[model samples]
Target: MTPAELGIGIVGLGSIGTTHARALRQVDGVEVRAVSGGAPGTAAECGWPGAVRLTPEDVLSHPGVDVVAVCSPTASHAALGAAAVEAGRHVVVEKPLATTVAEARRLAELQHERGRLVTMVAQRRYEPDYAYLKELAVGGRLGELRLATTHVHWLRDDAYYAAAPWRASMTGGGGSLMNQGVHNVDLLRWLCGPVEEVTAQYATLGHGIEAEDTTVATLRFASGALGLVSTSTATPPGAPATVALHTSAGAVELGQGEVLRWNLPGVPPPPPDEAVASGAADPAAIGVAGHARMWREVVAAIRSGGGHDADAVDAVETVRLLCAIYEAARSGARVRPGELR
Candidate 1:
């Protein structure tokens, strides 16, 4: 009700949407004023009982809504964000900002022209280990990055795919890399830089689904750093995902939320990090604390009349990379970035 408050309109009532609602509602001076997602009864049970349930358009056009959070599926993210941003509402997208580079770029330009706050949810950026790695990469503590390798192997049963129809297609979700491995995708790009080219192979593997369950790709960074990627949801008894960055000095390995290995001699790594719950095995298992922290940052950014970290323009690059990866795999050729337009 106060001028300091930000009324939020959240789209999608699935796990991530509920996660956002619960956390945003807890933040001071922020209200989950309205939501447009899931079925009415189901959405109500998730969170924000008092908030109005409206269609996405109505939610964005609503006067009380100061911001729109696109917690919807990957396919709906760009469309929802575009609508919200065009309506002059601040925006937040969950991940893969958009499926295509042009869509992401469009939102970025609109954000600039409209003078609105916009951010994408590459939540791993908020994770301590990844954040620390980012600091090292940016601060030159790890020296010039030569290569970054990642392995995101997880298991998802038939029922899991059945429950969420999106995971099985390119529309709602892309596949293992985009669905399960996207967080790591953002982290890799964030720690490394923009990717210039990618050569990849994608397959359905064992899952009875249309979307890919396994994929491998090699990346050429604009910074001249090359990287390797391996992702799948078919690995049995799935373990924590790992990313190893080989710099000129040494290598930095990141697991789930802990520093698996940090052997840079000149720059001493921090103390051992306690293992943190990674929503790797279970999407809903990731604690709401991270969302709470992100919301606080968003609220601050809004009040400051600026934008949050990983704004659409910044985060759109990640989506562009995702597109490149998929394209490379589909064509069985080395694909260059920005070629997905």
Candidate 2:
């Protein structure tokens, strides 16, 4: 099919939905044909000329919408995705896939049974430094990875959490680790391999919400590599969010869109100032332009009868790991991956 022939529908007109819509407008062979949400003023703000404003159900059932992008709240992801798959439309859902592993697994099974494409938005993996890190780790440059540590200390004020009631609720969405740090977690798993077990501690440090604001977890990967993940919304502004890896051969540090250091044992560490900057590496320029790239991949998969890169099953694994972490924290005992709800 030609570029003009591809029709797209965007569900949820929030910040994330806006990002996907804008990216779709820039991608070749795709059109942002419709948007569905109850957000006041979203129709005007989204700026899709001649775009249909309808309920999510209406959007999914629209004949013009060949691809459905679900950017709605985490709680609604499963329902929306199932609807799209039932309608035989290709789907791209934002992270977590669903609020629970069971829901995510169901979506995966349904999509598979219906022969439809379903993908999770894992944009961070497309970043140059991260892609390179995955390459190095998979190539054994890290030499049987001994340890990995991920820290996300970014600040999100009370106002930010209060922007939407669902921001800090386990039912509506989740806390810092699930909502914000899940991307890092997904990247960690993507680069290091699958998680075997988890033990965690969680607290509501600065927020009045029911969900956790700070979380620290220890992970055991199937490859026998150990990992430490620390994330919180309680940090002061300007604190750097980073992930560092300590392997048998050396260490690597990732901070704010750059590889801060790539040190090999006995080899002098590279100058910190000379580390590659992430902001300078635009995914768009490289033809992996964020959500647009995801859309393109979905289109290709549909046409070629191939599977999506971040399919629902893959996302369920991430969600399972997260659930295990939360459960372990609450019980004060190590949680195995298979034990997650």
Candidate 3:
């Protein structure tokens, strides 16, 4: 189908949804035909030219909308996705796919049965440095990977939680690991491989919420690689997002954006400043743009009649691993991915 003829509907007008709408508008072959959200005037704020305000159900059922982008709350993803699929529209859902494993799996199955693309928004995958790291890992440059670690530390004040009550309650999709750390978790699995087992510890240190503000997990991968993940919403401002890999060949440290250091057999580490500058690479380092690139890949996938770049089926594994982490922390015992369901 031609880009100009693609009709897209956005199902949420939150901060992320607005970003998605803007990205869609920027894409050559897509048009933001409609928008639905609980917020007042969200559709107008989304900046879509000819966007009509409607309910999610209305957006999905609208004959003019060929693609549905589900950017609603984490808890509502599954129901909205199912609704879009039933309407015979391709779906792009934001992260966490769903709040639970069962819901994510059901959505994946339904999408498969309908022969429609159901994709998850793993926008980090489009980041240049992350993309490069994925290439290196998949290329086996991290020979016989033995250990991997990812740290995501960012600040979220009490007011931040107060802004959205659901942001701090487990029942409402709260928790640092599930909400803020999900991207890192997904990235870990994507770079390292499937996690076979998980043991985690969670704590509520700063925020007075039912959900945890800090979490640490130890992972055992299917390939015998060991992994560690730590995430917190209480860090000071400007904390670096870091991921490191240790293999037989040596180690590679990814800090900020660029590759900080590579002590591999053949690749020598660049100078310190060069390493820092390179490691501090932004998600749009190469100018492909983050969400835009992701959308482009999804559009290409749809045109080719194949799976999305970030397929819902592959995302289920990440959700499974995330649930395992929560379970392990609560049960005070190691949990396996298979046992998550």
Candidate 4:
């Protein structure tokens, strides 16, 4: 079928769900066939004219829906994703594909066996500077990978969590690390390669919630490189996420989603547009450009009827990484990535 025939059906009308719908709507050939608001006929109640697929199964089974975008909460991902795949629909998960690594792997394997397109949202990969950094490392111009660091120190007030019922628990909500910093976790693995082990420490110093408000973890990459990841919702004045890559030859730093510094030998400086993306302090502050960029990749995969670049085939490792950090924080012992998978 042509790209114009690719109809998108989104489940979960939350912020991410809204973001995906808006992004898909902006595309030329794609159509928003229907949306499920996690209830019966809520899609039509919300004025969705295509089809009122109030339940996820309804959307997945709808004849008009060609791709199923799972924008639901963390806990619902594996089951919902499995349902979409079982129904033979293309699947796109928001982020942190599944709460646990094992479920994530299982879901991806099922999609693979079914020959369906499936991907996890890692929007930051659309940033040109990030691509430049990865290109440098792959070209061996950045020399050996030495150290990698990512910081997501942002604040979310009580109202932010209150507005969304799934913001702080292991079920729907997760601490700063799982919910907010999972993107950076994906970036750490994508840019720095696999993580062998992780040691972590965290506490609920800032919020009155059940999860940690602050979290810091040290990583040992399989490539013999050391890494650090810091994410928190406790900082009074939230700061934009930052990432730094140190190699044997030089270093590259990205502050607020832009390249603050690049000093590798022989490689030319990144283009100016590389810094266009930035993380906002508020949850609703996300820019649609990144979402649009990532969605375009999904659309392209649908058009080709084949491969996908951002497939969550390896996303299980990132989830495993976060789980290890949480386990290490609780048990106070360095943990391997697969311990809690």
Summarize candidate 1's per-residue lDDT along 1-341 as a digit string, tens digits.
35667788888777788888877756888877788867776545756677898888899998999999998778988888989999999998888788888888999998999999889876667667677777777787888889999988888888888987888997777599988888788878888888889999989987889999999999999889999988898888777888899988988887866677888897766554443566556766776766776788888888978767688878877888888899899998889886666
- Cα lDDT tens digits, model 2, 1-341, are 34345788989977778778776766667777788874656655555676788888989989999889998988898889999999989889987788887888988898889888888898777655676677777776667788998887766677777778898897787788888788788888888888999999999998799888889999999989899998887776525557788888888888755567778664433323222222212212212255565676777777778887688878888888888888899999989977665
Most lDDT-accurate candidate: 1
Global lDDT scores for all candidate models: 0.82, 0.78, 0.79, 0.80
Over 1-341, each residue of candidate 3 has an lDDT whose tens digit, in order, gives 33446788999876678878867765777778888874666655556658887888999998899889998877788889988998999999988888889988998898889989998888777666777768777787768899999887866778878877888888777788888788778888988888988999999987788899899999999999899999888766626667888999898887645566688887644333222221111211222246777898888888779777578898888889888988999999989987766
Q: Candidate 1, overall lDDT?
A: 0.82
Q: How well does each candidate superpose onto the true structure, as a TM-score? A: 0.93, 0.89, 0.91, 0.92
- List the candidate numbers ranked by lDDT, top first: 1, 4, 3, 2
Q: What is the lDDT, from 0 to 100, of the residue 177 in candidate 4?
A: 90
Candidate 2 vs candidate 4: the TM-score winner is 4
What are the runs in model 3 whose C-alpha is more than 4 Å off?
A: 1-4, 38-46, 268-288
In candidate 1, position 121 carries an lDDT of: 77
Once superposed on the true structure, which residue ranges of model 4 sit more than 4 Å away at CA?
A: 1-4, 38-53, 274-277, 338-340
Model 1 deviation from native, Cα RMSD in Å: 2.2
Clash pairs, model 4 backbone: none
Question: What TM-score does candidate 2 get on C-alpha atoms?
Answer: 0.89
